[model samples]
Target chain A: MTRVASMALATAGALLLQGCAGWQSALDPKGPAASELAWLIWFFTGLSALVWVLVMIALVVPLMMRSRAQAEPLAIDAGADGRKLRVVMTAVGLTALILVGLTLLSFFANRTLAAIGSDASLTIRVTGHQWWWEVRYEDATPSRILTTANEIHIPAGEPVRLLLTSTDVIHSFWIPSLSGKLDLIPGHMNVLDLKADKPGVYRGQCAEFCGAQHANMGTFIIAEPRAKFDAWWNDQLQPAAAPTADEAKAGEELFLKRPCVMCHRIGGTPAGGTVAPDLTHLASRQTLAAGTLTMSRGNLAAWIADPQGIKPGSHMPVVELSGDELNAVVAYLEGLK
Target chain B: MRAAVAMLLFPILVLAACQREERDTRPQSALGSGEQPTPVTTLEPGGQRASASDNKAASFEANAFHMSEGKRLFGWFNCSGCHANGGGGMGPALMDEKWIYGSSMESIHATIRDGRPNGMPRFGDKIPDDQIWELAAFVRSLGGNAPSSAAPQRNDDMMVHPSENRLPDAATLGKSP
Candidate 1:
């Protein structure tokens, strides 16, 4: 019985600890805003636990103690009664004080959060679609604004402002390791500021219950050094590399002729439709379908062939293609980077 | 035992009734049986006349799914680029009462199939006849010609104006400026 109890306790502990550290955990904070929020969470949790322990002790100790026998069952002890009233008053006063303290702490935390983006150096507009994120890097020059999807890159140690909005329903952008969740409302923009202290990749997700594929709507933030981030941005500004291979060339022709031209846009190509994610730098992205599947040739073919099977209710329609056409399209897309 | 069997079958029957198949393929009727060209008209001399034979408009315009599909295709085909969600930018406004090409379902179908005089590019070659019909139905809905039940509430994009389903009556709207 002892062994079984210990095993169960160990399993529970492991499960609890598993949530403490991960790329997507609030406790494993890598940015200032997240760290501040994490600290606040820990402080509140610790204080509550302490108060609970004190209350449990107060209740259990009295119950365990032997009560003195009363000489008269109806005898009123004024002195004892006065002491008991004072104790009750003290407990009530303490509870009020703790509540007020917590309120003040929360107010200050919010102030800190509000101040985070006041000095942001760069701004990016992130528009929430049903199950994807359209990331556009805003530049002073119209030609320099770069549009990408599902992934965001930022310079390490620099605060970046994100203008979040939704095209459809409400969605909340949450990269737990970076900052708190902010709702992306239709026709209303919300701003979020975050700064990663070091270079690392953090996973993010749509925290709001948007729709059918909401659970699969994942994103990533890649924080790197300033030089590397700049290089990446510059590279992304260029149009898609022209296909040199015969198979890829054939694939591009097929893509232009097919319904793929109707929704997806590839820079420097005549295929300029804007209803879906821009596929100019499709190969540069790490995952497909807003991180639903890892990026691979096989996965790309499968996704193109049966989008409904993969993402049930996605906007991408399956363009009927022969096996050769599928292979060619995949070849062309794979060379987009 | 009989009651238990009946109870188990009840859910299955209910679920079977819930199944609905959305047709994504082009229908044979959309092809017009080679009797007349499927609403393709042009401003050029001796251009084809708009025909009434290819009237699948009622079937598409009355169905909500087809209207929504048309809405999706409108965006996909970059119709919103020129039409600007039916409010019109480079092209004439679709929400207004005045349609340069007649407002009849066949006329609208012709306008989309063959380009208009000033700027509308011919989409007959690019878009399939079934999708063209859907687009025409959606375009009609923009003008409040479609049934209210068939029109879409809103698109998945930013809300710039009232949705097709919720727009005020076309009679209340002004002529295209």
Candidate 2:
């Protein structure tokens, strides 16, 4: 019986510890704001645990002690009663001090969080849709402003200010390993500043329920060296490379003719539709349908072929196409990188 | 045992009734006969009622799916570019009582099919007839002519005005433009 209980306990312990470290876990913070929040969380949790233990000890100690039987069971000793009152008062005083300490800790933590974004040099406007993020990098030059979806690239050790808003309903922008959750309400803008401590990929998710596919909404922040981040931004500004293969060329023609042209825009082509995400850098993205599936040719074909099947109630409509046309379109999108 | 079975079937029957049937977008001859080559600003010269075929096309005004589809198409086709989400930009304001061509369904259909002089381009060649009817229904709804139950609640775009569902019925406005 002991062996079975120990084995079960060990398994449960292992499972709980697994969540402590991950790309998305708040406990595994990779940025300044998240680290400060993690420290606050740990401090509060430790203090609360200590208080609970002390309470349990106080409750059980008297119960375990054998009290001397009095001649009159209801009679109380005046000296002992006075000692008990003093102990109770001390306990109350300590409780008040702990509560005040916690309040001050949280207050200081918020101030630290507010200061993280004070010297931010970069500004990106992030608009929340039903189940996707529309990231627009702001630049003084109108032509230099770059628009992308789902993925954000930032320079390591540099603070970036995010102007958040929503086009439709209410949603929240939360990157657990970088910062806290901030709501993106329609017609209202909220600003958040964050800086990655090192170069790494951190996953983010919509912390608020917006619509049907809200659970599938995911985003990524890629922190890289300053030079590499600049190179990526410049490359994204270029038009999509024209398809070299005959099959891909045919695919582009079909895409132009179909309803796909009505919602998506591919730079340098006449297929300029602003309602959906820009597909100019389709292959460059790490995932499809707002991270519902990984970026692959098969997943792309499956997504285009049956959008409703993968992400039901999405705005994407299924355009009827033959098997050959599907493959051709997939080939063309793959070459977009 | 029979009572239990009946109780189980009752909810299923109720749920089955809630299922909405999809609209058939295929062109029908019923609407074809009612279509007028020229726009009709008023009822027939003799003050006659609308034709049965005209009523058939107008019935789509009560369908929620049809109205929502029209709303989607309005954006997809860049109608908002000129119309500015029914408040109008270069084009006339659809939400207002003043309709230049006409307010009737058939008149609106004719205007869309054969573009009015100067501004409205001819979409008759590009868009199918069924879609034209849907657009007409949506335009009427924008003017608060549609049944409140069938109108769209809100749009995903930047807030401009009250949604179609919240607008007062056009009849209550008291005068026809």
> Which candidate has the highest DockQ of all?
1
DockQ (CA atoms), all models: 0.17, 0.15
Q: Candidate 1: what lDDT? A: 0.85
CAPRI-style grade of the A/B interface in model 1: incorrect
Instruction: Give the alpha carbon lDDT tens digit for every residue of B69-145 in model 1.
Output: 78878876778888898888998889965776677666777788777888998875566566777788888888887
Candidate achieving the largest TM-score: 1
Question: Which predicted model would earn the best lDDT?
Answer: 1
The DockQ-based CAPRI class assigned to model 2 is incorrect
Candidate 2 residue lDDT tens string, A1-337: 9999999999998889686798698988999899999999889999999999999998999899999778997887899899999999999999999999999999998898888889888899999987788999999999989988999999999999999999878999999999999999999999999999999999999989997789999999999999999999999999889999999999999888766776788988998887788899989999998889999999999998888788876777666578999999999989999
Candidate 1 regions with alpha-carbon error over 4 angstroms: A1-7, A63-75, B1-61, B72-120, B124-137, B143-147, B154-177
In terms of lDDT, model 2 sits at 0.84
Interface RMSD of every candidate? 4.0, 5.6
Model 1 CA lDDT for position A183: 98
Runs off by more than 4 Å, candidate 2: A1-7, A73-77, B1-77, B87-137, B154-177
